[model samples]
Target: MSTALTFTTSRRPDGAVVLTATGEVDMSNAGAFATALAGARQTAADTPFVVDLTAVEYLDSAGLSVLFPHVEHLHLIANPLLAPVLTIAGLDDVTTISE
Candidate 1:
């Protein structure tokens, strides 16, 4: 069965775009997460794109792959559980991640 995932985008007063994701991020719903990320990027290409993952209960390789290409432009805010995963995946080295 597919996992539940939802994305919400909001513009900050400073003009940055924040994409808040909730629920699990696994192979089952990674495609939708990628689509949301792409859409958020398209919404404000010039501004910073913040992806909030504090509410995400889990994330796997599929979700990490989807985030790889966007590292140059992504500022990730993740919870303690996912911070290590992102770091282990080498995403933290190339991108800014706050835990």
Candidate 2:
């Protein structure tokens, strides 16, 4: 099922930005994700980033592509369904995601 892309931000003492993404990340909301991630990057230039995708139930290549451009230390919290896709796509090693 398609899901909403809700965004919330938290700041670390060192200045890294943590944007929590809760819900499915599919074609529909991919742009929203990109926008949100972009906003975080603009605000926290040079700071590390962590996208908690544990609550995300689905993901597509477009969604993955949006993340490739920016952000370092990409952390996928716990997304079993999306993990395999990332792995097969060779993003599993490049992008860090936990199952």
- Give the TM-scores of the predictions, in the order they appear: 0.96, 0.78
Q: What is the lDDT of residue 10 in candidate 1?
A: 97
RMSD, candidate 1, Å: 0.8
Poorest lDDT segment (10 consecutive residues) of candidate 1 = 39-48
How well is each residue in 1-99 modelled by candidate 2, as lDDT tens digits? 345879898877876777888877888888899998888777667666777777777778878888887636455555676678777867666767677
Query: How would you encode candidate 1's per-residue C-alpha lDDT over 1-55 as one tens digit per residue?
Result: 8999999999888889999999999999999999999998889786669999999
Clashes of each: 0, 0
Query: Candidate 2 overall Cα lDDT vs. reference?
Result: 0.75
Candidate 1's C-alpha runs over 4 A off are none
Q: How accurate is candidate 1 locally (lDDT)?
A: 0.94
Q: What is the lDDT of every predicted structure here?
A: 0.94, 0.75
